[model samples]
Target chain A: MRNKWTKVLMSAMSASLLLTGASSAAMAKAKAAPQPVVLKVLYMSQQGYSTAVLNKMGAEFHKEHPNVTIEFTYLPYPQLHSAILTSAAAPVAQYDVVLSDLIWTGEFAAKGYTVALNNYIRQYIKNPKGIPQSVWNGLSVGGKVMAMPFLANFQNFYYNKKMLAEAGFKSGPKTMAQWLHQMQVLKAKHIVQYPYEDSWLQAEGLVCDYVRTAGEFGNGNLFNAKGQPIMNQGAALKALEWMRMLYKDGLANPNSLAADEPTAANAFASGQAAFNTNWTFVTGIMNNKSESKIVGQGVVSGFPVAPGTNRATLSASISGFQGLAIAANTPASLKPWAWKWIQFATSPAVQAQHLHSEWPIWSSVATSPQEKHLNPWYKVYQQNLNAVYNRPAVSNYLTVSSIIQQYVHEAIGGTIPVKTAANDMVQQIESLPK
Target chain B: MTSMPVESPPKRATLRHRLFRTLSGEYFWLYLLLLPSLLILVAVILIPMLFAFQMSLGNTSIVVLGGRGTISNQWVGLQNYLSLLQNPSFWQALRETLYFWVVSIFIEVTVGIGMAVLMNQSFFGRRIFRVIVFIPWAIPTVVNAMLWGMIFDGDNFGALNDLLLQWHVIQSPIVWLNPSALFPQIPWLSNALSYLGSNLAMNSIIVGDEWKTLPIVAILVLAGLQTIPHEYYEAARVEGASAWRQFRQITLPLIAPVLTVVLILRTMQLMRAFTLIFTLEQFGLPVLSIQAYQQAFSFGSFGMGSAVSFLIGLIALVIAYFYIKRLYREEL
Candidate 1:
């Protein structure tokens, strides 16, 4: 009787072990299967670029992962940053994927609003090498990638080809003096009312123009290694003085002081200005027949260097790249899907298709022969991207940029002399808490 | 008297019973009627003011949809205010604010009064003229600013520049919005006008704001003008009073109340002028409102911004106090 009881107990133990193992296997399979997810993407509302292209990419992403649905919220550039911050501060995550300005990387990372993308890149991204190291660096903070750089833009020199040719120039100016001479010729010949127009309004646009112009004269960096203001240096002063001269000499459009990017672009596209300096997107705008009176008449060239300086030393233009990142508040379950969307949006195929309007951050997409064939301006854009100047990556970049904007605007407005403005800027920046 | 006091000594009302009685009495409905508005005032105005005051006392640096969005209260009591006191930008903004307030209020009152007097006359198109005068006030302030921005645009395509060029008003197109261009160096009055001229950006903004607000002021003044009996004017006319004398003696005194109210209200509006100037010139002309906004939003210095805002509020309060005292004296 004792032997029979022992055998029965052994049989019961074996049955219980089998039951537990089977249940564990079923649970693992359930967890591995893709669950339904809805992701919200925040992006700028740029015409034909952000809204259209992002929606297309979302649809494609939906096709790949049928369980996932994408909901996009398009905001104006001025409102996008504020909206993202508001959503991040909410108790629950509002956005899964965010399209962020390069200037915002440090601030966002410091606030813990963005998750580190390095692990995702290593695990999910098949061709991380397709993105340039410089771009990756721009999107990274403290050895961790904060976002995936997708759109690359920089300031480029744009001029009316007809006006230049009419002024007896086969190519655009290569030096500051040559550029000034061409402006004079354009003014003298009545090819345009003003030699050039710019988005010099006392805003972020002014900072962009200032940095690009200063890079041609200065060390191509606004701050020193210690994060102290170096804009009062000789080269930067010369750049400010040059801009003042443009205003004083009636070479720059009088309205340029009040004009934002749209106004400047409109003035150029309306054939009211012979030359304009703007981002890469303006090239597509100027070339489009529907929106441009100067269609097929505009040409893109590298930003002019100082009179005798080599291109290597003074060829820098301000980079205005926008990238995508997963929100820090995003649930762990939703992170994989968010990263998947980012990858799909920034993939080579989509980038090549929108190459004419939206600049590519990927080296492969940027240099793709098919893309080059589709958009003739790709070569010039790539050339401009080669020597891009990034703004300071400090967490307080917005504040720093505002200070630069104020002093530089006062200088341009003649409220104070350029020297005084530069001194004031340095003093104010020095007074900022370390 | 002793016997009556003995009977009257029946217990005085309890505190709770008296409070309940007051609440349930004739004033109860009146209090109920005011409860919603009182709640709104506390929620919208009082709460925010208290919160801002609290923020001002701390080293709060919250830049709402940008920056770090973290609130750090290091308890730097009065440091922000002291720092602002020593800062040149703060003084400059204050100076600009005073200049804007004085100039905009003066122009608005003058134009508003002139329009009011003219519209008071029984003319053939008086109704049509009144409608025309109020059109500017009907337009949104931002829309008005944008419209004026386009008109005063410094480009050759600007309507004003184009018209002036066509009329040969000057040799070349003048940069209407350029602060430096507005005031050329005059040998005699350079010292006085130079500073003012360098701030033409502020003046241009003032022009835009006045265009939007003048109509409202005129309408208010006109309503006050209508309240005055024509018999007073008739009596003065029979007594051989000149139009100027009649206006100085009767019209001015009678309309002083309306004008005082207008001054107080307009002063408050101009003291906190942000949207029009922000939309027009941005930080081109730094007034207190713009300075506060820049401190809070652009620089993320919430404590400093709150201090700046309180300073502006204090100034407005002091000015309003004087105006109200003057109004009360006039009423007496």
Candidate 2:
């Protein structure tokens, strides 16, 4: 009887200690459960204002989610493409999120470096702060978000208001006919050295502009509506010929041969050239006291339309963002944290803050009319952004770009005729990988 | 059969021989003295070369790969090389590169020699002219490229067109950058050559690169010129040998060795040329080095770019091989 009583006492004592330990373990679990994860994001930058986007995005993202850490690596424009390819596509991807052009989605997705973010994207929709539907989702190879549009950089026309008025136009040219007439008037008065310059350096930039103005002027889709290659068409020919005619008319500057974006920007900024076509970043440069000659007087224009095409003005993006994707092999534990980060980055709060500066703010929903005049011609940039259509979102876009740059550069340099260059580019694009 | 009157030093002969051997020895004090510079060269050049060679063997992504570095990557054996064969742009770039190499080296050499000859002569303000000539070469390549790019802009507002039009030779300024618009007038630099005829591509290249390296050639030829005694020239003059004849026979042959060395050096520099080509090529022309760069970085194909780089190095090697042969022949 004495032994049984002692045993019962011992069992009660053991049960009580076990209960205490379970309760303590539960308390620790509650404390340690969902610690925020740090993420590393990388993107390329041009020589100019593109870098400003990265900075603004970083600060704004951190503000919304202080628990998550973010890091950014920026490179020069010429080197940015190569740098991204060499690093992220490698076996050990150094970045969690990469900022790239929408065209690169095909290559990255095809190679399986980027993950489909569809599963986690569902979580973002339920959040109190809604994730704006990405503009670049349709560009992805799969229905998944392969890369998100980090910024919206599109080609915009920069014209001198004074020069346009002096050419006998009350305002900027509305149609291609008036644009050509204005060039003639400018040349006659010797009021402008080069009446207009679009930086046709044979990179993707010039090609996008040509297609935009041409598409507005044409009967149908260029290359093809479905991202196929077909440049030897009449629409494409007319676009090339128009620029040629501009050169022949003695209205365009002969010195445009030497001017790429910087020189052209400098020419327009120095008040030497009456009109210049560049991206959204030129406004920041024009606003600067040391670099710009045209401050408040610079007027931005959508690209001029062809004579019969009722298109008001056609604007296009040389390169723009696609949906961003996480790595497939990212630690499962880090997924929820990374999605939260993606959500934070795409939030309107972040977009509004980033767009307030000189960077190309990609979020259409977040751009404010009040914040439209951040630089000398911010309003014009705003106008261009609304109409900006990304370059062909295809897998083999880069290969096509390489071949096209060679032919386009040659054609622009006047070695090959429009018909020949067009035909060669078509052949080259056909030969390019799809 | 006896060694023909071999002259031996009477004193300090053993000491001198020992010193010479010690200086040349692998682990000697002199070798130790050269260790730092050798270490620096290896660190800066050789190691990177090895890394680059390894990278060429891999399927490295140039875009989204991050900032030009990733320590370890997956290897794609020979895919890059195969891709290059398929790439039409590669062949086009190669053709352009060859043209640039041939044209640039030709111009840089001929004008370089001419400049050297001028500098060797007695002239007022020659020092200033020599310095002024070197200014273009002394400037960094990035700046040089940007400067020339500004001049080549296709707009009628371009500096080159303005200068040409102001000269009143043409009715209107031409689009130098545009390949579509047929230029009414020939701007000497933009004209294409029909291979082998007096190529003017040589002259355009001389505009940028010749200034820096010509002085080097001039100074080298000047060194060789000093070795040709004035007595020979005076004697020739006394014997009624014309100045042209003297230059053709004595000066030309005697200085030929050094000129050969200079030519080899210039060819090496010009063959691997990139900066000016990279900057200006965007305006419409590309050199061999520029082609190599675009292949590797622009297309994100490491293997192909590496192959092109190696090809360029190979072209340089051919020149070096000829030089080696010449050196061996000279020694003989």
Candidate 3:
């Protein structure tokens, strides 16, 4: 009887061991499979693809990756910086992916608020050669790519064709001197009072216009290669004097002292002014039948340069390109999925569809016939891109911008001499924390 | 008085019972009732204020961009304040703030009283008129600001310009807030008032603020007016006092307390007038409130921002103390 009991017990132990091993194997298999993930994305609402189109793209991304979901939030361009900073500072970041302006890349990367994307770009991107080297440099910090280039844009010159014709001009002005002369003629001919409209409000718009104008005068670079400000010298100083002259002579709209980008664009759109320079978003607004009175009259061109300055290769139009960065604090488990979405969304294939509204970041997509056919101003936009100027990429660019805005605006308003304002602006910028 | 019931001094009570009785006393309950509000006040107001004060004493700025959102600080006591004192911009901002405060309050108070007196009289559509007066106040500050912004806009499409052109009162549009155009050219005065900012810009802001704030002040004064007894006025008339005389002697003195309260409240509000000015012209007018915001957010110099904010609080406190003391003496 003892022998029979021992054999039965051994059999029971063997069967239990088998069952436990099978269960453990099944659990391991389940763990290896993809788990459900939800990613939150933030984008600027003022420009770029509409939220509806983005939502559709997100849905498509979800279909391809069955277990992942994408959630998106949109804020205006001005609010995006603050929101990005606030979210990155939170205990657990509020966003997994964020759209950042070109100006913010340095600051965001330097702070470790955004993750470096060099490794991911190498492993994931197929045929990355299509992207321009400058585009890559714009999205990098300390020689590491910190973001993926999303939208390519610059301040393109917009004008009313009829107004130019009325002033006896056949084409847009190629130099600042010519433009000023044309504006004077238009003003004297009673064609348009204050022939040029400007968004010289005390904000980033002022800085962009200044940079573009400085570029026209010569070098638009605010800082030298050694990262020291040269704004009190050379082209930068000349730009301010020219701007002040415009305001003093009443060649530029006096209302520009308080106008923002939209207000300036509206002035051109309504045919109240002959010429304006603004973002590519104005392309749609200028020619829209419902939004513009100059639907067929508005024409696009490369930004004008100073007469003595070289206008051959680059016109120095300030580039307002934007890109995507993953939050540094995003969970490791979720980052791969986040990258997947970014990779898919900013892919040349998906970006090509929005060419009419936004400039494509990929050169291959940019030169495609579809893009040129969709955008009538494709030739001018392309020409402007050849000579685009990126704003100073310092970590404290916004602070630098604020100082410039204040002094430049004061100078234009005639509160102080242009030389004094320039000198003071440079001094304040130099005093910022390194 | 009826004899109070004096009960037992009989048995020795246990310690727990004595404690319970003590806690159940009226004073304990009164304190217990105040506990929640006191806790809320400490957490919401006192604690943050203390933090702000502490921050003002050091170079404590939120260096989010470079430090991953950590607050970077170095103890540099009184430096922020001293620097602010020396800064011309700060002084200019302070001057603008006072200008905004004094000018707006005077307009609101004077217009408010006139409105209250007019509304106090028996008139047709009195109810409708009251509602109409309240409409500006009821509309949000931002909406009111935008409305006035469009009205005062320099463009030909602006309401004021369109109206002026239609009436042939002006042949061309006026840049209502252009600082250069608005700067007074008195040789002696120009240099002194160089940093006083655009009078026209400041005036436009004051006008917008007055239009929105007048209704509330009128309504408040109207409430005080209603509380007066009719017999006093009747008695004044019987005594053969003139209408203006009655108003000067009776109405003015009687409504002094209400007016004092309004003045104190409006003074505080005007010192911190941010939304109206910001919506109309952001950083266009470098008033104290806008300066504080710019220092903190734009420049990320939270230390300087705190110093400015702390100074503003001190100024407000000094003014309030004067008002309170005057009120106390008046009561005496």
Candidate 4:
């Protein structure tokens, strides 16, 4: 009877141990469950990925992370900068993630508005695999990764092949002189009254166009290694004078002085102009039946070189790429999830899926045969990316850009001389608050 | 009990009676009734104006102020004002604002008076005409600006351009939104015209502003016109006074008070006019309000923006003071 009692006691003890172990394992899993988080994100409504694509991606992200939710707010491109600045001034961040323009990376980072992603990149990204060095250079400020490369864009040269053929040209012009000659013929023949449509308005569009032209006509960089303005002389001066000549000689549209990018795109898409330079997004607009009159006749090519200039390896388009960044004031608990959202959004697979809307930041996806097949402009975009005139990464870049815009616009408007405009631009930029 | 109550009531002043006596004093209840509004005015208007003045004396950004940091650290007394005085953009913007004010006020008063007189007549479909005149005023400023922007667009798709083309007014489209392009290319005339601040762009803005602003002035003037008895016109008609003479002597003098008030009010509104110009021309027109907007919002320089704001407020106040003084003097 005693032996039977011992066996029962031992069996009971073993059963209790097994029960405790099972319960502990279950409790640990419950503890490890992710906390629910709602991340507020801000993005530009125009250009880059559409809201629908981003929403679809958000839904997919929620599928993997059932505990996380993404809330989005869209503003126009100009308002996005102000909104981000205004919101970041708050103690608790209003947005957890923001889409930052490449031009704003320096300013945003310097203001401590965005969190550095170096640690997150090291932990999650491991290898940036296909992102180009130039892209990283744009997203980094003071050797700190302020954002993740999200979209790659540049000023793309778009032409009407049918118009050029009618003007007795087989292919697009390889140099500015050749393009000018072709425009003259097109104008003389009355095929198109204004052969070149440019965004030379008194805004950022003017600066972007001027940068590309200066790169093609002037020296390689507007600022030197010491980060000083050198646009007062050399290729920059010539580029400004050439732009004035285009407008004065009646080769460029008279409305070019008042036109922005969309206006230029409209003029090109409606078969009103034979040659135009605009963002890569214009390709979609030019080919879209609803938005274009000469849909299939539009051709995409790298920016042309100035006459007597040999830049075989590098092209002279402005780097108009953008990035995804985490706000600095995001709560510590929500930061990890913010990084996850950025990672998923910028992943090569996701970017490749939406390749038709925007160019992938990954060099591999950009050059992949599948992506190339999907976007024929990818080939030309790759060539344009070879050497782009990156607006110098300065904290005061907006002020600098504004000064350039005003002077260049004055020159184009015939309110000031080209040399005086160039000299005044340098003077004003140098005088900006440090 | 009656004798005791009469004796006791003679000696004491009760708190309720004393309070009632105080309340019955001159304008006490009037001020007491206005307490809520006064509090609101102090909160919304007085506090912000004072704070803006404080900021105007400093060199700070919205970030610093928004973060609740001590602005004294960034203080540079009167430097913002001094710098603004030296800034060429500020002078240009001031010139544009003056031009806009002079043109808009003149047009608003003249057109408003004309509309008021016409509407005062016993015409058929008068009610419908009044509503049609008010439709532009009822439309939101943003929507109106956008509508006008589309009409003034320098594209082939623009309404004005398309209409002009269809009507055979011109063989080629004119770039209406650009001042330099819209003006004739004659050297002497262009230079003279530039000095006068009479660009097509500003004139286009005035046209849009007048469409929306005329009704308010007209309604005010109409109310004033109604106050003048029909007997006055009948008396004048009984005399040898002509129609033009009667209008000049009777209508002009009678509506003068309302017109002065409307002009002063419109001056304040026009000096702060930003949405119309900003929406239409963007950075193209650097008027005072746009300058303030750019400094505060675009450049994030709150100090400079506040200085610009204070200057605008001071100008409006000075003009109001002069007009009000004249009004009181005329009354006396």
Candidate 5:
């Protein structure tokens, strides 16, 4: 009886050990698969500031994802246009990701180089609340989304608080006439320092600003509502005339024609100009003691409204989260990994942390009171984001923008008459392949 | 074979043995000396050249192919070439190129000779001036272009406008970049005499290029000056020759070869004058290289681009050939 009991007990013990081993194996199978990824990113950070923020983010990202390595490359602001296009065209996946000015989405997307993130967006981010819907508009074409917005950038008028006050105004001019009256008042009073200054050079920034303002005044689309050319209309010519008046009256700095985006920002912060139009990042840059002469002295507001228009037109530029696109040709195996990394990087928690360092595309991150409380600048940025107008998302957008810039520059310089410049745009756009 | 060569077992070895031995040695030595270099040259240059040539000839882009009018679908033969030939823009670019080259070369060659001659003379600051003259060349082309661009900026921020106003040369500032301003855009190379022409004048004006590129010519002239013995100068001076006379006679004659060398080099390189023109475009001067670049890279019309490129090469060769026939006739 003792030997029989001993054999039975031994069998029971062995069975228990074998059962434990089987259960452990099942648990291991249920655990998540380790997705190995090397995410390569290409972006431009303002030489010092953005780079610092990116480095900090990289460290955090690495800590969170020890298996995934990050490769980041920075380009100068001016060359971003050429660099992004060339990289996208090259055979090697020069960068697994890309960041650029907003206008590039149409060109990059149409080329089918950007990876479609629609499935990923629906799956990973069900309700990215704080980001603007306008951000999504730039990423989609013909029902397919080519990229995801990394951040928000909407145009705002940057005015010198002190200069405006001295010019007998407490805040920015609400309307175009009011602004022109202010310029005249300042000029007559000799309170004007740099004249009625705004950068209207032949570039996307100026063209967008002008187009938006014209749209504000009910000038049909700068390219017409049907996406056909109509820039030769009266409203556009009037706008051109108004700009010319600034130069003609010597109200604007003579160097205004050659100035690019940052140069305009520099001029405004230096108190060399009374008012200028710019975007949200100006707040962070101007607040720095070393860079600005008017720290805490500049105020952000909506751009001046056109006469007879109920609202001011708002335009978007890329200074923050640019749309993320994955190449169509990327391997199916890499697709899931790419989607996951994009989801993680653009997550609300991550975006909120990196807020204003890059423009946040997540509505939740952009509008979070928590975010506004920290930066304060996002309040103005978010307001502008609410009314943002993106450029026509078409493949030939780059060609179109170049044409506009050239014609605009010619008109402003008086080299080509305003009417002629406007007409030229119509002719050129019509001549281009539909 | 052994029996045929066995004539008292020749110390130097039979002809067959010698030929085989030499062939084997040559194989190792030749390959050892040239293999790596050949491999690298093929990898870097020859292959790329062949690829580019094939692309230029084919109907389709090797890299980015697709579309009804794509590289392959459209059997447009040299229709792309024919179109480029007829393009007004192409002609405009060619015209601008000629204007840029002729003006830049004229100023650079003349000023370079002057500087070289002066450097050859005894002076207090000769070394300093020579070094200073070389400074622009030492600086990158973009930097040099920037420096000159700064000088011509008609805007208040321009150093040139400031200087001119300070000297009371003008009461009001000029719009060197604007074609419409009363201070009309200066055509520095063609229409303007360098002084009246504004910064745009550099496209027409020699200053845009003359000072920037003069160093290359100066160095070449200096080499020629060195080769001409001091005896020639001594003889001219002994005859109580005027400075101008000596310059025309001994100096010009001996320096002609170096002058031709610099001239040939400049002609070859003149087709690719993008840095200065590209820089100036920021201020709004459209030159040929930039226009062509825009057509190709910006517009993505590889056929038109290749045609433009081929034309540029053709013109440069023609110019070079003319110079070669005139100056390098006997020696070459």
Candidate 6:
């Protein structure tokens, strides 16, 4: 009887242990599994570069989390901003992540379309210091970080090295006068059809170009401390005059007035023009063997200062940085995942891998040896970034940009005198409510 | 009363009998049949237009992206319209639009008539020719604009520039689409004329637009031509009347009504010309439609944009009314 009783007790203990172990295992599995989420990311279509990178990153993320799915919708660059704004304003959240333009930070934030990313960056990102202060400034509004800067873009002076060399200059011009002289020499020698080309199309691009030019000449400030327009000042007038002279003297491409950045880049890449003033991505585009006739013949330098001003006085070219932001309407359940995705995408390693296409935003990625090997133009881009200027960040930036574009375009086109155009731009911008 | 009650009381009309009489009445079924169309018209046209006018009377910058979803308005009677009227760009756009409307209609009608005359003829490959002519019309307006944008590209690769250069027609390439470049080419013109020289850009746009619209106008005129008895032409031939005379007298008078219809339609289309101008010139050569689009979408000034839209509609209505009145007068 004692033997039988001992056997029953042993059996009961063994069964209880098995039940405890199985229940624990099941609970752990359930805890480990993430809630199924589908994140829709809205970004500009850059011929599949953004889509490809995002897809690869998303797949890797999915492997670890196992339940999150990523969907991407790409729009043309011009349409993407409006699309994001429209989607964010919808009753239900349409996009979890939006690849936002740097200039839109203030407008998006003020309109309450994007959530402040300060907390997320602090908690999720390993090294928030990786992103440069300048880039961070570009993505901040009301002293709060609104986005994760993914791509750093600013204008760089790109010259045809072969043409410059042939023109008896070993490097790009340093001043406005020197640049004009070199262009004249280039035109006289029949080395190039046009000495310079610009993407001065009457769009936001024209606003960017105008701001950069005006800033370089006008003591690095296009606005007063009160945000009043100073583009009608003497220095700004000189900048406008210089642009007009280029058109009048036939130094710049006649089509430059109508050409956007892509068209201007094409003009330079095809070896039709000796110089191109454009963003850093043109380096990779012009260097690509399939796209360019001037492969290995293109070189970069800082944009020329006005004749009297030195490089130190000249402000940076207009910033065209693109960043990623979470929509304010994003469900609270998905905020953590969205923050995680942003952290992963803008991390140093991922940025380094896609440095050439997306121009690294993080200082660490830019300085890394691996990225240096990948993008030879990194140093030049970094130098240009140092001198970058940005358009006034305001809730009415789009309207203000349109007004600036109209006046500047009219000035360049000679539809109105430069003085009139400048005065009109100031009066119009000032007339807007504070 | 008791004696009168012996007679049958007059029967009162029943509701069913009245309903039957109404249904059987003349034009009742016709009105019933038209109910669906009237409802559709109200839904698609009248409601939106009325809403737009109401919105224009408010001082609302309700950008869907920039505002809460709620439709809130700050009532400011006629403020939007007054502001638009006072704006210089509005005046400039109005001037440019008038020029565009007049020039496009004239060119399209002239070219359209020529095409209709040709297509009206019997030929071996007439079907193939008709199809070819209609291809541009079949293309979406935006696609047509893009097509012409490439063709008129100011670069070395542009087909027009390449052909001109190859033929040694010019020493350098012409920036066909750049208004600024095209302006200086005519030095003899006055400053006002020089200012209007951007009309050359409009001319290029008109060419593309005409190519697309010419086919429809031609088909309409061709239909009118078919209606005219060939017997008239045969009789005129026997009478020794020249082809020009026949065209001037019989052909023209017969097609006048069709041409008038085309004129009114094309004028309205040109006044509301947005896609082609927006795609090609954008704000380069601002017009009423482009201005409305820029104000609405680009600037998010919905009230001002709606005001601009109604202005265009009013202008179109006035012009269309005059044309219809003239047609009536001609018929009388």
Clashing pairs in 3: none
TM-score, structure 6 vs. true: 0.88
DockQ for every prediction shown = 0.25, 0.21, 0.30, 0.28, 0.16, 0.28
Ranking by lDDT: 4, 3, 1, 6, 5, 2
Q: Which ten residues in a row have the lowest lDDT in candidate 3 chain B?
A: B61-70
Give one digit per residue, the lDDT tens place, for model 5 in A49-101.
37777767667777878867767788765456555555545554556666645
TM-score of each: 0.88, 0.75, 0.90, 0.90, 0.83, 0.88
lDDT of 4 by residue, A204-265 (tens): 78888888888888464678889889778888887898899998888898788878888889
What CAPRI-style quality would you assign to candidate 5?
Answer: incorrect
Q: Tens-digit lDDT track for model 1 on A1-434?
A: 99999999999999999999999999999899988889998888985466777788888889999989999999877667666765665545678889888888888777677888888789878888777666777788788888888777677889898888988988888778888999988888887768899988888889888877887764557788887788888667878988988887878987788888888988899898888989877887898898899998899888788865535534567788788988877777788888888888877877777775677778887778877787677777766787677777888788888898888877986768999999989888887776
Best by DockQ: 3
* DockQ, prediction 2: 0.21
Compute the lDDT of residue A163 as modeled in candidate 1: 83
Predicted candidate 4: interface RMSD?
A: 3.4
Please give, for residues B26-45, the per-residue lDDT of candidate 6 as tens digits: 86888799999999999999
Question: Candidate 6's residue-wise lDDT over A1-434, tens digit each?
Answer: 99999999999999999999999999999998766899888888774246777788788778867788878887878677767755764655688899989878888777677888888777777777777777888889878888888878788888999998998998887777788899999999889878888987788887777777765674545677787878788666777877888887889988888788888999999999999888777888888999999999998777787765636534357788888898877877887888878887777777666765667778887888877888776777777787777788777888888888888887887878989998989899989976
The CAPRI class of candidate 2 is incorrect
Runs in model 1 with CA error above 4 Å?
Answer: A1-41, A48-74, A85-89, A93-97, A188-190, A307-314, A329-337, B1-14, B63-70, B187-198, B330-332
Model 3 spans with C-alpha error above 4 angstroms = A1-33, A311-314, B1-23, B63-69, B181-194, B330-332
Computed on alpha carbons, the lDDT of every model, listed in order, comes to: 0.81, 0.63, 0.83, 0.83, 0.66, 0.80
Q: List candidate 6 stretches off by more than 4 Å.
A: A1-35, A55-66, A218-220, A307-315, B1-44, B63-68, B181-190, B194-198, B330-332
